[model samples]
Target: MKQGVLLIAVLTLNGCSSISPQECEVGDWFAIGKTDGQQGIASSKFRSYQKECAEHGLGSDFKAYEQGHAEGVLLYCTYDAGRELGQSGGAYNKVCTGALEPTFRLGYDRGRKWYQAESALLNLQKTLEQNAGTIEKLEQRIDDNTRELSVLKDKQQKQNLLDENRNLLQDLRQLNQMQGQLQRDLKQAELQFSLIQQGG
Candidate 1:
Protein backbone atom coordinates (compact mmCIF):
# COMPACT_ATOMS: atom_id res chain seq x y z
CA MET A 1 0.00 0.00 0.00
CA LYS A 2 2.84 2.34 0.76
CA GLN A 3 4.51 1.57 -2.54
CA GLY A 4 1.28 2.14 -4.43
CA VAL A 5 0.78 5.43 -2.69
CA LEU A 6 4.31 6.46 -3.53
CA LEU A 7 3.82 5.57 -7.15
CA ILE A 8 0.57 7.52 -7.30
CA ALA A 9 2.22 10.48 -5.67
CA VAL A 10 5.08 10.37 -8.10
CA LEU A 11 2.71 10.15 -11.04
CA THR A 12 0.64 13.01 -9.70
CA LEU A 13 3.68 15.15 -9.17
CA ASN A 14 5.04 14.33 -12.60
CA GLY A 15 1.69 15.19 -14.22
CA CYS A 16 1.04 18.25 -12.12
CA SER A 17 4.01 20.32 -13.13
CA SER A 18 3.08 21.15 -16.73
CA ILE A 19 -0.33 22.78 -16.59
CA SER A 20 -1.51 25.17 -19.31
CA PRO A 21 -2.69 28.68 -18.42
CA GLN A 22 -6.23 27.99 -19.60
CA GLU A 23 -6.42 24.72 -17.72
CA CYS A 24 -5.01 26.35 -14.60
CA GLU A 25 -7.66 29.04 -14.64
CA VAL A 26 -10.52 26.72 -15.51
CA GLY A 27 -9.51 24.11 -12.94
CA ASP A 28 -11.75 21.52 -14.55
CA TRP A 29 -9.33 18.63 -14.35
CA PHE A 30 -12.05 16.05 -13.96
CA ALA A 31 -13.70 16.99 -17.27
CA ILE A 32 -10.33 17.05 -19.01
CA GLY A 33 -9.42 13.60 -17.75
CA LYS A 34 -12.82 12.21 -18.69
CA THR A 35 -12.53 13.57 -22.22
CA ASP A 36 -9.03 12.18 -22.54
CA GLY A 37 -10.10 8.76 -21.38
CA GLN A 38 -13.14 8.75 -23.68
CA GLN A 39 -10.88 9.58 -26.59
CA GLY A 40 -8.46 6.79 -25.70
CA ILE A 41 -5.65 9.19 -24.97
CA ALA A 42 -2.63 8.06 -22.94
CA SER A 43 -2.41 8.78 -19.21
CA SER A 44 0.86 10.53 -19.92
CA LYS A 45 -1.18 13.43 -21.26
CA PHE A 46 -1.92 14.35 -17.68
CA ARG A 47 1.77 14.77 -16.99
CA SER A 48 2.02 17.15 -19.92
CA TYR A 49 -1.01 19.03 -18.70
CA GLN A 50 0.57 19.18 -15.26
CA LYS A 51 3.73 20.73 -16.65
CA GLU A 52 1.71 23.26 -18.62
CA CYS A 53 -0.33 24.21 -15.59
CA ALA A 54 2.79 24.45 -13.41
CA GLU A 55 4.26 26.99 -15.80
CA HIS A 56 1.22 29.13 -14.97
CA GLY A 57 1.80 28.61 -11.22
CA LEU A 58 -1.12 26.22 -10.95
CA GLY A 59 -1.38 22.66 -9.63
CA SER A 60 -3.26 19.67 -11.05
CA ASP A 61 -6.16 18.01 -9.25
CA PHE A 62 -5.03 14.40 -9.53
CA LYS A 63 -7.80 12.92 -7.41
CA ALA A 64 -10.59 14.52 -9.45
CA TYR A 65 -8.90 13.53 -12.70
CA GLU A 66 -8.50 9.94 -11.62
CA GLN A 67 -12.13 9.66 -10.63
CA GLY A 68 -13.37 11.06 -13.96
CA HIS A 69 -10.87 8.95 -15.95
CA ALA A 70 -12.21 5.80 -14.35
CA GLU A 71 -15.75 6.75 -15.28
CA GLY A 72 -14.75 7.57 -18.89
CA VAL A 73 -12.76 4.36 -19.24
CA LEU A 74 -15.85 2.35 -18.39
CA LEU A 75 -17.52 3.85 -21.46
CA TYR A 76 -14.47 3.37 -23.68
CA CYS A 77 -13.67 -0.22 -22.70
CA THR A 78 -16.90 -1.80 -23.84
CA TYR A 79 -16.81 -4.56 -26.49
CA ASP A 80 -18.96 -2.57 -28.92
CA ALA A 81 -16.77 0.48 -28.48
CA GLY A 82 -13.67 -1.62 -29.06
CA ARG A 83 -15.12 -3.07 -32.25
CA GLU A 84 -16.09 0.37 -33.54
CA LEU A 85 -12.66 1.77 -32.85
CA GLY A 86 -10.92 -1.15 -34.51
CA GLN A 87 -13.18 -1.11 -37.54
CA SER A 88 -12.36 2.55 -37.94
CA GLY A 89 -8.66 1.58 -37.94
CA GLY A 90 -7.95 3.32 -34.66
CA ALA A 91 -5.02 2.21 -32.53
CA TYR A 92 -5.53 0.76 -29.04
CA ASN A 93 -4.47 3.11 -26.26
CA LYS A 94 -4.02 0.18 -23.80
CA VAL A 95 -5.84 2.00 -21.04
CA CYS A 96 -7.96 -0.97 -20.07
CA THR A 97 -6.69 -3.59 -17.64
CA GLY A 98 -7.68 -6.86 -15.99
CA ALA A 99 -10.50 -9.02 -17.44
CA LEU A 100 -12.10 -6.21 -19.42
CA GLU A 101 -8.91 -5.76 -21.40
CA PRO A 102 -8.97 -9.23 -22.81
CA THR A 103 -12.56 -9.06 -23.98
CA PHE A 104 -12.14 -5.60 -25.52
CA ARG A 105 -8.91 -6.69 -27.23
CA LEU A 106 -10.60 -9.74 -28.68
CA GLY A 107 -13.31 -7.55 -30.18
CA TYR A 108 -10.75 -5.12 -31.56
CA ASP A 109 -8.71 -7.80 -33.26
CA ARG A 110 -11.67 -9.44 -34.91
CA GLY A 111 -13.19 -6.13 -35.92
CA ARG A 112 -10.01 -4.92 -37.51
CA LYS A 113 -9.63 -8.12 -39.48
CA TRP A 114 -13.21 -7.98 -40.57
CA TYR A 115 -12.88 -4.36 -41.63
CA GLN A 116 -9.77 -5.09 -43.69
CA ALA A 117 -11.38 -8.05 -45.41
CA GLU A 118 -14.49 -6.07 -46.17
CA SER A 119 -12.45 -3.27 -47.65
CA ALA A 120 -10.50 -5.71 -49.79
CA LEU A 121 -13.66 -7.30 -51.06
CA LEU A 122 -15.12 -3.91 -51.98
CA ASN A 123 -11.96 -2.94 -53.88
CA LEU A 124 -11.91 -6.23 -55.77
CA GLN A 125 -15.54 -5.86 -56.72
CA LYS A 126 -14.93 -2.32 -57.90
CA THR A 127 -12.00 -3.36 -60.03
CA LEU A 128 -14.04 -6.15 -61.51
CA GLU A 129 -16.79 -3.67 -62.36
CA GLN A 130 -14.29 -1.37 -64.02
CA ASN A 131 -12.91 -4.28 -66.02
CA ALA A 132 -16.43 -5.15 -67.11
CA GLY A 133 -17.00 -1.57 -68.26
CA THR A 134 -13.76 -1.67 -70.24
CA ILE A 135 -14.79 -4.91 -71.85
CA GLU A 136 -18.11 -3.39 -72.86
CA LYS A 137 -16.36 -0.47 -74.52
CA LEU A 138 -13.94 -2.82 -76.25
CA GLU A 139 -16.84 -4.92 -77.56
CA GLN A 140 -18.52 -1.80 -78.92
CA ARG A 141 -15.33 -0.79 -80.70
CA ILE A 142 -14.89 -4.26 -82.09
CA ASP A 143 -18.41 -4.33 -83.49
CA ASP A 144 -18.05 -0.89 -85.03
CA ASN A 145 -14.70 -1.85 -86.58
CA THR A 146 -16.10 -5.08 -88.01
CA ARG A 147 -18.92 -3.19 -89.67
CA GLU A 148 -16.56 -0.55 -90.97
CA LEU A 149 -14.19 -3.23 -92.26
CA SER A 150 -16.93 -4.97 -94.23
CA VAL A 151 -18.07 -1.76 -95.94
CA LEU A 152 -14.60 -0.40 -96.70
CA LYS A 153 -13.45 -0.56 -100.31
CA ASP A 154 -9.79 0.24 -99.59
CA LYS A 155 -7.64 -2.76 -98.69
CA GLN A 156 -5.28 -0.75 -96.53
CA GLN A 157 -8.08 0.66 -94.40
CA LYS A 158 -9.61 -2.81 -94.02
CA GLN A 159 -6.28 -4.22 -92.89
CA ASN A 160 -5.85 -1.42 -90.37
CA LEU A 161 -9.34 -2.03 -88.99
CA LEU A 162 -8.62 -5.76 -88.71
CA ASP A 163 -5.41 -5.05 -86.77
CA GLU A 164 -7.27 -2.72 -84.39
CA ASN A 165 -9.87 -5.39 -83.82
CA ARG A 166 -7.15 -7.90 -82.97
CA ASN A 167 -5.62 -5.51 -80.47
CA LEU A 168 -9.03 -4.94 -78.86
CA LEU A 169 -9.49 -8.71 -78.59
CA GLN A 170 -6.12 -9.04 -76.88
CA ASP A 171 -7.00 -6.34 -74.36
CA LEU A 172 -10.37 -8.00 -73.77
CA ARG A 173 -8.66 -11.27 -72.99
CA GLN A 174 -6.35 -9.61 -70.44
CA LEU A 175 -9.28 -7.83 -68.80
CA ASN A 176 -11.20 -11.10 -68.60
CA GLN A 177 -8.27 -12.66 -66.82
CA MET A 178 -8.15 -9.76 -64.37
CA GLN A 179 -11.86 -10.00 -63.74
CA GLY A 180 -11.55 -13.71 -62.95
CA GLN A 181 -8.77 -13.07 -60.46
CA LEU A 182 -10.72 -10.26 -58.79
CA GLN A 183 -13.77 -12.48 -58.48
CA ARG A 184 -11.68 -15.14 -56.80
CA ASP A 185 -10.17 -12.65 -54.39
CA LEU A 186 -13.57 -11.20 -53.52
CA LYS A 187 -14.92 -14.67 -52.80
CA GLN A 188 -12.04 -15.46 -50.47
CA ALA A 189 -12.31 -12.16 -48.65
CA GLU A 190 -16.05 -12.53 -48.22
CA LEU A 191 -15.60 -15.98 -46.77
CA GLN A 192 -13.00 -14.82 -44.33
CA PHE A 193 -15.14 -11.87 -43.29
CA SER A 194 -18.14 -14.09 -42.73
CA LEU A 195 -16.12 -16.46 -40.64
CA ILE A 196 -14.77 -13.66 -38.51
CA GLN A 197 -18.21 -12.20 -37.90
CA GLN A 198 -19.66 -15.59 -37.01
CA GLY A 199 -16.75 -16.72 -34.89
CA GLY A 200 -16.47 -13.49 -33.03
Candidate 2:
Protein backbone atom coordinates (compact mmCIF):
# COMPACT_ATOMS: atom_id res chain seq x y z
CA MET A 1 0.00 0.00 0.00
CA LYS A 2 2.83 2.39 0.88
CA GLN A 3 4.72 1.64 -2.35
CA GLY A 4 1.53 1.92 -4.44
CA VAL A 5 0.67 5.28 -2.88
CA LEU A 6 4.22 6.44 -3.41
CA LEU A 7 4.07 5.36 -7.08
CA ILE A 8 0.77 7.12 -7.67
CA ALA A 9 2.13 10.27 -6.03
CA VAL A 10 5.22 10.15 -8.15
CA LEU A 11 3.12 9.62 -11.33
CA THR A 12 0.81 12.47 -10.36
CA LEU A 13 3.81 14.75 -9.89
CA ASN A 14 5.00 13.62 -13.31
CA GLY A 15 1.62 14.79 -14.82
CA CYS A 16 0.38 11.30 -15.75
CA SER A 17 -2.63 11.34 -13.41
CA SER A 18 -4.20 14.51 -14.79
CA ILE A 19 -7.99 14.16 -14.68
CA SER A 20 -10.75 16.49 -15.83
CA PRO A 21 -14.06 16.40 -14.02
CA GLN A 22 -16.46 17.88 -16.58
CA GLU A 23 -15.05 16.56 -19.86
CA CYS A 24 -12.16 14.62 -21.34
CA GLU A 25 -9.70 16.76 -23.27
CA VAL A 26 -7.13 15.96 -25.95
CA GLY A 27 -3.34 15.67 -25.38
CA ASP A 28 -3.85 14.27 -21.91
CA TRP A 29 -2.71 11.00 -20.38
CA PHE A 30 -5.23 8.91 -18.42
CA ALA A 31 -3.84 6.79 -15.63
CA ILE A 32 -5.44 3.86 -13.80
CA GLY A 33 -4.14 3.00 -10.36
CA LYS A 34 -5.30 0.05 -8.26
CA THR A 35 -5.90 2.49 -5.46
CA ASP A 36 -8.33 4.48 -7.65
CA GLY A 37 -9.65 1.24 -9.29
CA GLN A 38 -10.68 0.51 -12.91
CA GLN A 39 -13.92 2.49 -12.71
CA GLY A 40 -12.13 5.79 -12.19
CA ILE A 41 -9.62 5.16 -14.93
CA ALA A 42 -12.36 4.12 -17.39
CA SER A 43 -14.42 7.17 -16.65
CA SER A 44 -11.59 9.68 -16.67
CA LYS A 45 -8.33 8.44 -18.16
CA PHE A 46 -9.76 6.16 -20.88
CA ARG A 47 -12.17 8.88 -22.00
CA SER A 48 -9.36 11.39 -22.29
CA TYR A 49 -7.21 8.93 -24.22
CA GLN A 50 -10.04 8.08 -26.60
CA LYS A 51 -10.95 11.70 -27.17
CA GLU A 52 -7.35 12.58 -27.97
CA CYS A 53 -6.86 9.51 -30.13
CA ALA A 54 -9.96 10.23 -32.19
CA GLU A 55 -9.12 13.88 -32.66
CA HIS A 56 -5.48 13.32 -33.53
CA GLY A 57 -3.61 11.52 -36.31
CA LEU A 58 -3.20 7.74 -36.18
CA GLY A 59 0.53 7.84 -35.47
CA SER A 60 0.03 10.65 -33.02
CA ASP A 61 -2.51 8.71 -30.98
CA PHE A 62 -0.43 5.57 -31.11
CA LYS A 63 2.53 7.47 -29.76
CA ALA A 64 0.42 9.02 -27.06
CA TYR A 65 -1.03 5.64 -26.05
CA GLU A 66 2.42 4.11 -25.94
CA GLN A 67 3.06 5.90 -22.68
CA GLY A 68 -0.19 4.61 -21.24
CA HIS A 69 0.50 1.04 -22.34
CA ALA A 70 3.91 1.22 -20.76
CA GLU A 71 2.47 2.51 -17.52
CA GLY A 72 -0.16 -0.18 -17.49
CA VAL A 73 2.39 -2.85 -18.19
CA LEU A 74 4.54 -1.56 -15.39
CA LEU A 75 1.58 -1.61 -13.01
CA TYR A 76 0.71 -5.12 -14.14
CA CYS A 77 4.28 -6.29 -13.60
CA THR A 78 4.45 -4.56 -10.25
CA TYR A 79 1.36 -6.40 -9.05
CA ASP A 80 2.46 -9.69 -10.57
CA ALA A 81 5.69 -9.51 -8.61
CA GLY A 82 3.78 -9.39 -5.38
CA ARG A 83 1.43 -12.34 -6.11
CA GLU A 84 4.19 -14.56 -7.51
CA LEU A 85 7.68 -13.57 -6.42
CA GLY A 86 7.36 -11.04 -3.63
CA GLN A 87 4.87 -8.83 -1.77
CA SER A 88 3.81 -5.67 -3.67
CA GLY A 89 0.19 -4.48 -3.92
CA GLY A 90 -0.89 -3.41 -7.46
CA ALA A 91 -2.75 -4.68 -10.56
CA TYR A 92 -1.26 -7.98 -11.77
CA ASN A 93 -3.29 -8.63 -14.92
CA LYS A 94 -1.26 -9.71 -17.98
CA VAL A 95 -3.35 -7.28 -20.01
CA CYS A 96 -5.55 -4.33 -19.12
CA THR A 97 -8.60 -6.34 -20.37
CA GLY A 98 -10.83 -3.29 -20.41
CA ALA A 99 -14.55 -3.50 -21.07
CA LEU A 100 -14.48 -1.35 -24.23
CA GLU A 101 -11.35 -3.03 -25.63
CA PRO A 102 -13.21 -5.54 -27.81
CA THR A 103 -15.63 -3.01 -29.22
CA PHE A 104 -12.95 -0.49 -30.08
CA ARG A 105 -10.77 -3.19 -31.67
CA LEU A 106 -13.57 -4.34 -33.95
CA GLY A 107 -14.34 -0.79 -35.02
CA TYR A 108 -10.70 -0.04 -35.77
CA ASP A 109 -10.35 -3.17 -37.90
CA ARG A 110 -13.46 -2.34 -39.92
CA GLY A 111 -12.37 1.24 -40.48
CA ARG A 112 -8.92 0.14 -41.67
CA LYS A 113 -10.41 -2.36 -44.09
CA TRP A 114 -12.86 0.20 -45.44
CA TYR A 115 -10.05 2.69 -46.03
CA GLN A 116 -8.01 0.05 -47.88
CA ALA A 117 -10.93 -0.78 -50.12
CA GLU A 118 -11.52 2.86 -50.88
CA SER A 119 -7.85 3.29 -51.77
CA ALA A 120 -7.97 0.28 -54.10
CA LEU A 121 -11.06 1.61 -55.82
CA LEU A 122 -9.41 5.00 -56.33
CA ASN A 123 -6.29 3.36 -57.81
CA LEU A 124 -8.39 1.23 -60.13
CA GLN A 125 -10.20 4.30 -61.36
CA LYS A 126 -6.89 6.01 -62.12
CA THR A 127 -5.62 2.98 -64.03
CA LEU A 128 -8.81 2.81 -66.05
CA GLU A 129 -8.54 6.48 -66.95
CA GLN A 130 -4.99 5.99 -68.17
CA ASN A 131 -5.99 2.98 -70.23
CA ALA A 132 -8.85 4.97 -71.75
CA GLY A 133 -6.43 7.69 -72.80
CA THR A 134 -4.13 5.14 -74.42
CA ILE A 135 -7.03 3.62 -76.29
CA GLU A 136 -8.13 7.02 -77.51
CA LYS A 137 -4.63 7.76 -78.79
CA LEU A 138 -4.54 4.43 -80.64
CA GLU A 139 -7.91 5.10 -82.20
CA GLN A 140 -6.72 8.54 -83.31
CA ARG A 141 -3.64 6.96 -84.85
CA ILE A 142 -5.78 4.42 -86.69
CA ASP A 143 -8.04 7.13 -88.07
CA ASP A 144 -5.03 9.11 -89.28
CA ASN A 145 -3.59 6.00 -90.93
CA THR A 146 -6.92 5.33 -92.64
CA ARG A 147 -7.06 8.89 -93.96
CA GLU A 148 -3.48 8.62 -95.26
CA LEU A 149 -4.28 5.31 -96.96
CA SER A 150 -7.33 6.85 -98.63
CA VAL A 151 -5.21 9.74 -99.95
CA LEU A 152 -2.62 7.28 -101.29
CA LYS A 153 -5.35 5.34 -103.15
CA ASP A 154 -6.62 8.55 -104.68
CA LYS A 155 -3.09 9.47 -105.83
CA GLN A 156 -2.61 5.98 -107.35
CA GLN A 157 -5.82 6.32 -109.35
CA LYS A 158 -4.71 9.73 -110.67
CA GLN A 159 -1.29 8.31 -111.66
CA ASN A 160 -2.94 5.41 -113.49
CA LEU A 161 -5.14 7.86 -115.42
CA LEU A 162 -2.11 9.98 -116.34
CA ASP A 163 -0.24 6.88 -117.64
CA GLU A 164 -3.20 5.87 -119.82
CA ASN A 165 -3.41 9.40 -121.26
CA ARG A 166 0.33 9.32 -122.12
CA ASN A 167 -0.06 5.93 -123.91
CA LEU A 168 -3.02 7.26 -125.98
CA LEU A 169 -1.00 10.36 -127.00
CA GLN A 170 1.88 8.16 -128.18
CA ASP A 171 -0.50 6.03 -130.28
CA LEU A 172 -2.03 9.20 -131.83
CA ARG A 173 1.46 10.48 -132.75
CA GLN A 174 2.33 7.17 -134.49
CA LEU A 175 -0.85 7.30 -136.55
CA ASN A 176 -0.16 10.87 -137.66
CA GLN A 177 3.35 9.91 -138.81
CA MET A 178 2.04 6.96 -140.89
CA GLN A 179 -0.57 9.21 -142.56
CA GLY A 180 2.12 11.75 -143.58
CA GLN A 181 4.36 8.99 -145.09
CA LEU A 182 1.44 7.57 -147.15
CA GLN A 183 0.64 11.03 -148.58
CA ARG A 184 4.31 11.53 -149.63
CA ASP A 185 4.45 8.10 -151.33
CA LEU A 186 1.27 8.84 -153.32
CA LYS A 187 2.68 12.16 -154.63
CA GLN A 188 5.96 10.51 -155.71
CA ALA A 189 4.10 7.76 -157.69
CA GLU A 190 1.91 10.37 -159.39
CA LEU A 191 5.10 12.24 -160.53
CA GLN A 192 6.57 9.05 -161.94
CA PHE A 193 3.42 8.38 -164.14
CA SER A 194 3.47 11.92 -165.40
CA LEU A 195 7.13 11.45 -166.52
CA ILE A 196 6.18 8.24 -168.46
CA GLN A 197 3.38 9.98 -170.29
CA GLN A 198 5.75 12.76 -171.32
CA GLY A 199 8.28 10.27 -172.60
CA GLY A 200 5.64 8.49 -174.73
Candidate 3:
Protein backbone atom coordinates (compact mmCIF):
# COMPACT_ATOMS: atom_id res chain seq x y z
CA MET A 1 0.00 0.00 0.00
CA LYS A 2 1.26 3.50 -0.83
CA GLN A 3 2.14 5.66 2.20
CA GLY A 4 -0.32 8.56 2.36
CA VAL A 5 1.28 12.05 2.15
CA LEU A 6 -0.24 15.14 3.70
CA LEU A 7 2.56 17.66 3.18
CA ILE A 8 1.42 20.98 1.76
CA ALA A 9 4.54 21.84 -0.23
CA VAL A 10 4.95 25.40 -1.34
CA LEU A 11 5.33 25.73 -5.11
CA THR A 12 8.31 28.08 -4.71
CA LEU A 13 10.44 25.42 -3.04
CA ASN A 14 8.99 22.20 -4.46
CA GLY A 15 11.80 21.96 -7.03
CA CYS A 16 14.44 22.44 -4.33
CA SER A 17 13.88 19.08 -2.65
CA SER A 18 16.06 16.07 -3.50
CA ILE A 19 13.34 13.80 -2.13
CA SER A 20 11.32 12.29 -4.93
CA PRO A 21 7.66 13.27 -4.89
CA GLN A 22 7.04 9.65 -3.94
CA GLU A 23 9.42 9.89 -0.97
CA CYS A 24 7.90 13.20 0.11
CA GLU A 25 4.45 11.64 -0.09
CA VAL A 26 5.49 9.05 2.45
CA GLY A 27 5.41 11.64 5.26
CA ASP A 28 2.16 12.72 6.89
CA TRP A 29 2.45 16.39 5.79
CA PHE A 30 4.96 19.07 4.95
CA ALA A 31 3.88 22.72 5.14
CA ILE A 32 6.43 24.03 2.64
CA GLY A 33 7.29 27.70 2.25
CA LYS A 34 10.56 29.60 2.16
CA THR A 35 10.70 31.29 5.56
CA ASP A 36 13.09 34.16 4.95
CA GLY A 37 15.06 33.88 8.14
CA GLN A 38 12.39 36.59 8.02
CA GLN A 39 9.05 34.92 7.18
CA GLY A 40 7.28 31.77 6.01
CA ILE A 41 7.69 28.13 7.17
CA ALA A 42 11.33 27.33 6.47
CA SER A 43 12.06 23.63 5.90
CA SER A 44 14.76 22.85 8.47
CA LYS A 45 12.66 24.20 11.31
CA PHE A 46 9.69 22.00 10.49
CA ARG A 47 11.84 18.89 10.28
CA SER A 48 13.31 19.75 13.67
CA TYR A 49 9.75 20.14 15.02
CA GLN A 50 8.79 16.77 13.64
CA LYS A 51 11.73 15.34 15.46
CA GLU A 52 10.86 17.32 18.60
CA CYS A 53 7.34 15.95 18.69
CA ALA A 54 8.50 12.45 18.00
CA GLU A 55 10.99 12.79 20.81
CA HIS A 56 8.22 14.09 23.06
CA GLY A 57 6.27 10.85 22.75
CA LEU A 58 3.18 12.54 21.38
CA GLY A 59 2.83 9.07 19.94
CA SER A 60 2.16 8.10 16.35
CA ASP A 61 -1.51 7.18 16.86
CA PHE A 62 -2.86 10.65 17.64
CA LYS A 63 -5.91 11.97 15.73
CA ALA A 64 -5.92 14.88 13.33
CA TYR A 65 -7.05 17.40 15.96
CA GLU A 66 -4.24 16.45 18.34
CA GLN A 67 -1.83 16.58 15.46
CA GLY A 68 -3.31 19.91 14.38
CA HIS A 69 -2.86 21.39 17.85
CA ALA A 70 0.72 20.21 17.91
CA GLU A 71 1.11 21.76 14.51
CA GLY A 72 -0.47 24.99 15.72
CA VAL A 73 1.98 25.25 18.61
CA LEU A 74 4.82 24.67 16.19
CA LEU A 75 3.37 27.23 13.78
CA TYR A 76 3.23 29.78 16.58
CA CYS A 77 6.85 29.06 17.31
CA THR A 78 7.76 29.35 13.63
CA TYR A 79 5.94 32.67 13.24
CA ASP A 80 7.60 34.12 16.30
CA ALA A 81 10.97 32.87 15.09
CA GLY A 82 10.36 34.51 11.73
CA ARG A 83 9.40 37.82 13.36
CA GLU A 84 12.56 37.79 15.49
CA LEU A 85 14.70 37.13 12.44
CA GLY A 86 13.04 40.04 10.62
CA GLN A 87 13.77 42.41 13.49
CA SER A 88 17.33 41.22 13.93
CA GLY A 89 18.11 42.20 10.30
CA GLY A 90 19.19 38.69 9.42
CA ALA A 91 20.92 38.16 12.76
CA TYR A 92 20.66 34.51 11.77
CA ASN A 93 21.44 34.78 8.11
CA LYS A 94 19.78 32.27 5.79
CA VAL A 95 22.05 29.38 4.88
CA CYS A 96 21.26 27.37 1.71
CA THR A 97 21.93 23.71 2.45
CA GLY A 98 21.73 20.66 0.11
CA ALA A 99 23.82 22.11 -2.72
CA LEU A 100 21.51 20.49 -5.29
CA GLU A 101 18.53 22.37 -3.84
CA PRO A 102 18.51 25.57 -1.84
CA THR A 103 16.02 25.31 1.02
CA PHE A 104 14.90 28.72 2.25
CA ARG A 105 17.23 29.24 5.25
CA LEU A 106 15.36 29.63 8.51
CA GLY A 107 15.65 28.30 12.07
CA TYR A 108 17.00 29.04 15.53
CA ASP A 109 20.75 28.90 15.08
CA ARG A 110 21.23 28.98 18.86
CA GLY A 111 21.83 25.61 20.44
CA ARG A 112 18.46 23.87 19.83
CA LYS A 113 16.31 23.88 22.95
CA TRP A 114 13.57 21.26 22.87
CA TYR A 115 11.48 21.19 26.03
CA GLN A 116 11.32 17.71 27.38
CA ALA A 117 8.12 16.18 26.05
CA GLU A 118 6.81 16.25 29.63
CA SER A 119 7.49 19.98 29.87
CA ALA A 120 5.79 20.64 26.58
CA LEU A 121 2.75 18.71 27.75
CA LEU A 122 2.69 20.67 30.96
CA ASN A 123 2.98 23.94 29.11
CA LEU A 124 -0.05 23.08 27.02
CA GLN A 125 -1.98 22.25 30.18
CA LYS A 126 -1.01 25.56 31.79
CA THR A 127 -2.09 27.45 28.71
CA LEU A 128 -5.48 25.78 28.87
CA GLU A 129 -5.88 26.63 32.55
CA GLN A 130 -4.90 30.24 32.04
CA ASN A 131 -7.36 30.58 29.18
CA ALA A 132 -10.13 29.07 31.30
CA GLY A 133 -9.41 31.43 34.16
CA THR A 134 -9.42 34.40 31.85
CA ILE A 135 -12.81 33.38 30.45
CA GLU A 136 -14.39 32.89 33.85
CA LYS A 137 -13.14 36.21 35.13
CA LEU A 138 -14.48 37.97 32.04
CA GLU A 139 -17.87 36.28 32.38
CA GLN A 140 -18.18 37.26 36.03
CA ARG A 141 -17.21 40.81 35.23
CA ILE A 142 -19.83 40.92 32.49
CA ASP A 143 -22.51 39.61 34.85
CA ASP A 144 -21.53 42.14 37.50
CA ASN A 145 -21.66 44.94 34.98
CA THR A 146 -25.06 43.76 33.79
CA ARG A 147 -26.39 43.81 37.35
CA GLU A 148 -24.93 47.26 37.99
CA LEU A 149 -26.38 48.57 34.73
CA SER A 150 -29.82 47.27 35.65
CA VAL A 151 -29.68 49.10 38.99
CA LEU A 152 -28.53 52.27 37.26
CA LYS A 153 -31.35 51.94 34.75
CA ASP A 154 -33.87 51.60 37.56
CA LYS A 155 -32.53 54.76 39.24
CA GLN A 156 -32.35 56.73 36.00
CA GLN A 157 -35.91 55.72 35.19
CA LYS A 158 -36.85 57.34 38.46
CA GLN A 159 -35.79 60.74 37.06
CA ASN A 160 -39.17 60.77 35.31
CA LEU A 161 -40.52 61.23 38.83
CA LEU A 162 -43.54 63.32 37.80
CA ASP A 163 -44.79 60.79 35.27
CA GLU A 164 -44.08 57.68 37.35
CA ASN A 165 -45.48 59.15 40.53
CA ARG A 166 -48.49 60.27 38.57
CA ASN A 167 -48.92 56.75 37.23
CA LEU A 168 -48.50 55.21 40.70
CA LEU A 169 -51.02 57.66 42.14
CA GLN A 170 -53.50 56.90 39.41
CA ASP A 171 -53.11 53.20 40.01
CA LEU A 172 -53.58 53.68 43.73
CA ARG A 173 -56.65 55.86 43.19
CA GLN A 174 -58.16 53.24 40.94
CA LEU A 175 -57.31 50.53 43.47
CA ASN A 176 -58.77 52.64 46.28
CA GLN A 177 -62.02 53.02 44.39
CA MET A 178 -62.35 49.30 43.91
CA GLN A 179 -64.86 47.67 46.21
CA GLY A 180 -64.12 45.43 49.17
CA GLN A 181 -61.42 42.81 49.59
CA LEU A 182 -59.54 43.59 46.35
CA GLN A 183 -59.26 47.27 47.32
CA ARG A 184 -57.92 46.31 50.72
CA ASP A 185 -55.37 43.98 49.08
CA LEU A 186 -54.16 46.64 46.58
CA LYS A 187 -53.69 49.20 49.34
CA GLN A 188 -51.74 46.68 51.39
CA ALA A 189 -49.43 45.96 48.44
CA GLU A 190 -48.89 49.67 47.80
CA LEU A 191 -48.10 50.23 51.48
CA GLN A 192 -45.58 47.35 51.45
CA PHE A 193 -43.82 48.67 48.34
CA SER A 194 -43.65 52.19 49.78
CA LEU A 195 -42.17 50.83 53.01
CA ILE A 196 -39.54 48.88 51.08
CA GLN A 197 -38.69 51.82 48.81
CA GLN A 198 -38.39 54.05 51.82
CA GLY A 199 -36.02 51.54 53.42
CA GLY A 200 -38.63 50.75 56.04
lDDT of each: 0.76, 0.43, 0.40
Model 1 C-alpha lDDT per residue in residues 60-126, reported as the tens digit of each score: 8878778778777877787877887788878875888886698788778877987887788888888
Model 2 lDDT per residue over 1-200, tens place: 44435545654564654333212322233233332332123223445545544554321233444555555544443322223221112232224346534443343444444444444445555555554555455455545555555666577765665565556556555655554554555455555545533532
Instruction: Report backbone clashes per prediction.
Output: 15, 0, 3
lDDT of 3 by residue, 1-200 (tens): 22332233432245433334343334334223212222333445545434444665432322432344344434334534543443344544333324311222333322111112223344545555554555455455545555555556566654554455555556545433443444454456555545433531
1 or 3, greater by lDDT: 1
Could you tell me which 10 consecutive residues in candidate 3 have the lowest summed lDDT?
109-118
Best prediction by lDDT: 1
TM-score winner, 1 or 3: 1
Per-residue lDDT of 131 in model 1:
83
Off by over 4 Å in 3: 1-115, 154-200
Leading candidate by TM-score: 1
Q: What's the TM for model 1?
A: 0.75
Global local distance difference test of model 1: 0.76
Q: Could you estimate the TM-score for every candidate?
A: 0.75, 0.30, 0.21
Q: Which of the two candidates, 1 or 2, achieves a greater TM-score against the reference?
A: 1
